[model samples]
Target chain A: MGYEEAFPPADMKWAGNAAKRFASPFVDVPHDRIDVDAIILSHAAVASGYTIRDFYEKPELGIHCVAYASAMYDLLPVTHWFFSLPWVTELGIRLEYKDTLPPIPAAGQEHVLKDPSDVDKIHVPDKNELDKGWTLPMFKRLYTYVQKNLGHTLVPISYGFDLVGAAAELCGVENFIMWTFTEEEAAKKLVRKYTETAVNGAEGLADTFGSAMLIVGSVLGNNDIFSDEAVKMYSADNMKYYVNQCFRKGAGPQVFYHLCGNHETDYKVFKDTLMWSPFTVIHAGYKARDPFPSALLKSEFQDRATCMGSVDTKLMIAPNPKAVYDQAKKQLLEGRDSKRGYILGTSCETPPYTIPGNIYALTRAARDFGTYGTW
Target chain B: MEVIMSDAVKELIGKRGLKVADVEEVVKNGKAIQKKGTNHYIASKMIGDVTAYAEYDLESGILKKKANVTSAYSHRIKLIKVDKLDEVSDYVMGSTPVHNATLQMEYMTVVRSGPGLATADGSVLMVEEYLATKTLAVAEGLFEKKRA
Candidate 1:
């Protein structure tokens, strides 16, 4: 209902468990169970029986719902929506909120940048604009409350470190892709602008948030957009500059890579390139539309980083509980024995409208198969 | 969910320079409409940039089943992943016509220690054969002692 009801300041047991659950893969904190860090968005409402409109209008409800639903379903982690919206908001993207859904990009919000030279189209957000929404002022307050009162870190960047995708979003996709070859220097300047904003903005608030988790949701870095050659020789090469800079600059305490689309060609390029934080968890999304199996991730990544296996959002949205349970079981069995540790997660955000039974199915699968040493 | 990888299947993956992750992608993304009759599903995927389709049914990088051959690669020399870096390093050192053994080690040190994915530990690699070939010779000319 409000920040006071969001997370209890006295709940050290809950706080410690939640902290260890997320920190387990990277640290020896003794949390060995397989669980979900679903990045549950408005979908937090889907699990808690609240309307999506309520989550956005009163994000504390979303926070409460996350805790409520996570406990209800025995899910081990929770995420907030504030980490994402400001990226679009800073781009002058208008959002139209609805009664039953999170805000969507308003119609007629044209791509803001006309060319690579239109570098002035975006700017680094100041602390005030960090919550630039009719209702978003609450996030700044809630996050501050969470950290100071609850002793927890709140920010995990979703779309940060994605220099290529962020730049493309500003200009149109085709224009940005063409300029990578035709106007290379100008394009790099444009990408560097967004990269600096993402990195520096976090750095500026380092004392407040304690640590920024630089998560790279390189959505546009998917194989469909560029050849393995061009992506390797170009896109990934360009973005790695910022990635190295993120590490070299000490932008965060950890880095999470959510390669959000088909990466069959792109992963090879990334596998041998790019820096990873010790707490790195790479959750590569579906290929074409199928979830990237966890077994492949283990073979490919070894113990270099924790590999998270995902259940498709599509399957979760369906009413078929058995399918969700089966898929979750498959992913849990495959990844539960990973040498570097494994997490069962949704491919992206668990869709806000996903049916309740399907959401419960993930918890059921975890109990049946994800308990440590069973595999 | 069940796609078997025999030794021959693994070799097909290795020779092409791909990883198990790539095959998982191909299989999962595919309709897997069991061929009208065959056990092998014709796994197809859309290629990057270029309007084309590429098939990627690579084996998982782990060599659980023994193989007569080892190394894994991608075009222009990127390692998808390798079972034994020593085996691949030996081939590059003893064979590759680019340079002599001494020069090769010097070059590889520079490569592994440099930047990007191929860290000194050598779990996964980013090999640059063509570029390194030219660079190695340049280094040799600049540093190697002239025979009296």
Candidate 2:
């Protein structure tokens, strides 16, 4: 396959604006628009009539989907590919795929790490060996595609599947949760194993793409789905401590905390420990399905983090773009003056078939109501 | 100007978000009432007025730092004395306390860490979180009676 494909000139004014927002969020630079990301992937594929299977199987199509969707919707702070299977599939778990559905681990599939003791099997793929896998080659092509075609410095973000949360999927999720309470020693040992994979994976991608905004997400391991006591026993208390080891191993300056769960119970765990990067954007998910109050996030994290506003993902699927616009405007109003910084985003990934009008409305609201302030 | 807190107490306190700065300020300036006869001192209620019953070595009339300043009550209830604020945080965090006992005896540990008082009915609490379970009015009352 020829590595080069023909493309037209892309509008990159949004990239420059986003770069300024990232570099000096609070500096009084003349930025008229705040950065907005729609998590616009599945919709991009749909625009091209390419299914979820094609995006993963055709590695080259991954960048094309992100590019087409980001440009189609004028999404800022452009991202390359985003999917969870590239991570889970490597664990020897069987995956079920369809035209409409993203690759998901098959139900009742035997977990590769069937027991906590099997944690010893999780070897971190060294830096050199990373590209031999499916994820890195796509990353190489993405960076090359961005630089070669657009002459733009695309900051491809790290994949969002956090190590500790992904580790549970490696060993059946239920089994791992039970082990945290019943077999404490074994669970912590597994944590170290997953931390290595996570750090090595980030190091590998950054090596491939030069630099990236490391998105360390810890959601499936949060207290809402898990118990508060167990979260302390393992996820919050242990995962955070081990993940910080990435800094010592050499990571990028920016870290995006995809804290995508109801954090009412364990917010302190993150407030106290999770943030280690100089440039941090903390994405708050929800408190009981409604958007976690942006004001509360601002209050707790504004001193140290750029709080991302959670425009509800359900709104993205709403027939009317006005619903998405109103939600984005509400988030912008409360989150705009966050002392540290603010970026508007959906509560999480916008569902696959989310209408394009809703995506554009999100950006329109961002420009209409976004903070027009110093850098 | 002279507050003598043992290194163990200092280390334990550090775990509860008390920096050396806060401890020095509270110890030097905060009122420390000696726990009756024990060398330990109960400093003025701090940290949301939860009343950290600092286990301290009392020097004459001065408040000196010690550990488990509440052995005074755990002394009576047959519960092990837990004067360390870290243990208070641990217990609040659902950690098994130093001494395992029946639920009744467990509640008996209602924080004898000096500043706290275990009531006749065994209902008082000192950890900041437990204080919020009551109404604002009742919470303020609990706050007032938090320190014996």
Candidate 3:
């Protein structure tokens, strides 16, 4: 069957509901065609909201695209085959799958960089090389296929490289931590190399797709893993460079940085780095200690950059849909007074098994409490 | 589908010097031997050459479970081991002491006159002391009892 036949667009009933409630741009459903379960779940989620006859009936939801094709290659079985290929294996990078957990990048028990000097071994594949590689090809195939099918209905979000995360994957968390302290020079060099490559790659994707927003996933830059000082010195510094490069390359003005952990201490670094940048959005992931992102929006970023997310993933799993609605209400109320825009979403990716009821409650709460000018 | 460990359980395993992978392997391969609570289940099986246990709380979405059994077993040795010499030294030192020497079986080192004691070995004295603590924890309802 054709891809479109296998995974049909959102149900007309649900689409219509979503369209009535939400503005032109609505919440972008992640991976609505991965399987039968996804299709059913996506329909349920859409039905729960005000929908439009077509996916592109409104442009307000901005550009809705699934970039997971590139970011989460480890989840696919094809990745294992790609890793086993002689050509890919020669690069000294292998995909490590443990039971059912997401695949990790490793060089045997150690990372590609055993020591500081091994920074030279760190290879940031150029665009041509990446296009020829196995994983990227698979990602491109999925992206292109989705674009070809859904492009008319939805804006396609292309993939952008995550430099901080890519560095951690290459060096391994342990070695990366050690290098930060003991081998600062080599660590910095490696980070710089990765940062430059990521900037160029992201710019290229932006140029190709003409996407409205370029999302840079930098979960490793959170304060949970690094001290506030280190976050500024490393993550913040590189982010500044990234934003500058994107603008320089005319990769659209809006840049959304996805940092998916606790960043109470390092949040300021983000503010300082991107507050002045053009049309920035901070996709703050959920933190158990602080379940609200309104403080971030209302603060120094009040008039600057949009803030997205703060809903705890745990709440989505709560048996009571009211719990999800309550949290969503709280998030909306907190951001009500902010001059900056706020987008309601889960702190991170919605778990594949998230109940349809809870997903419905989220959009329901957004419609109930997220009304513009409704305090 | 495999159960994902909660952050609390992950932190517990890290503190106990066990890899999350070890506990995950047991959970994936082990048979369900018992139920602990409404959402929790206990699985037991032999993984590779070692017997393994996993406690999973399934209510929290597809992921999110408490692996108490893995955390318990991973720290079994450290939890059971006690240092009688350090206890003796603490008693001898009382509130004040210039210096004191005591043997720590766990660390395989002699504790020589210090405010705090450090041991590198896994051996300890009076296994009952450890058992008492476990009993206390169980009595305190830290872990759920097996369903009847």
Best by lDDT: 2
Instruction: Tell me the TM-score of chain B in each candidate.
Output: 0.29, 0.36, 0.38
> What does candidate 1's lDDT look like per residue over A1-375, in tens digits?
445554434444665565566555544333646767666767777555678787786665666666556655556654455434335556566667777656666678787787666765567565455545332244445556545543343553323645676666667668888887798776766666666655544544443444445666667768878777756655566555555555444344355777777876577776555554334678878766688888887777645567888888888888899998899899888888776678888888788877878878887887788876565
| Candidate 2 residue spans exceeding 4 A from truth | A1-7, A13-18, A21-30, A94-96, A106-109, A150-153, A237-243, A371-375, B1-148
Ranking by lDDT: 2, 1, 3
lDDT-wise, the better of 1 and 3 is 1
Worst 10 residues of 2 chain A by lDDT: A21-30
After superposition on all CA atoms, what RMSD does each candidate show versus the true structure?
A: 19.3, 14.6, 27.2
* Pairs clashing within candidate 1: A272-B117, A273-B117, B17-B73, B20-B60
Error of 2 at A340 (Å): 1.7
Query: lDDT value for candidate 2?
Result: 0.57
Model 3, stretches more than 4 Å misplaced?
Answer: A9-92, A96-101, A106-110, A158-162, A210-212, A275-278, A286-288, B1-148
Better of 2 and 3 by lDDT: 2
Give the share of true interchain contacts found in each model: 0.00, 0.00, 0.00
* TM-score of structure candidate 2: 0.66
Number of the top TM-score candidate:
2
Q: Candidate 1 — which residues are off by over 4 angstroms?
A: A1-3, A6-18, A29-32, A82-85, A91-105, A120-140, A148-162, A178-185, A233-239, A248-250, B1-148
TM-scores of the candidates, chain A only: 0.83, 0.87, 0.74
lDDT of 1 by residue, B71-131 (tens): 2222321223322222122212112311111111222111111122222344223323222
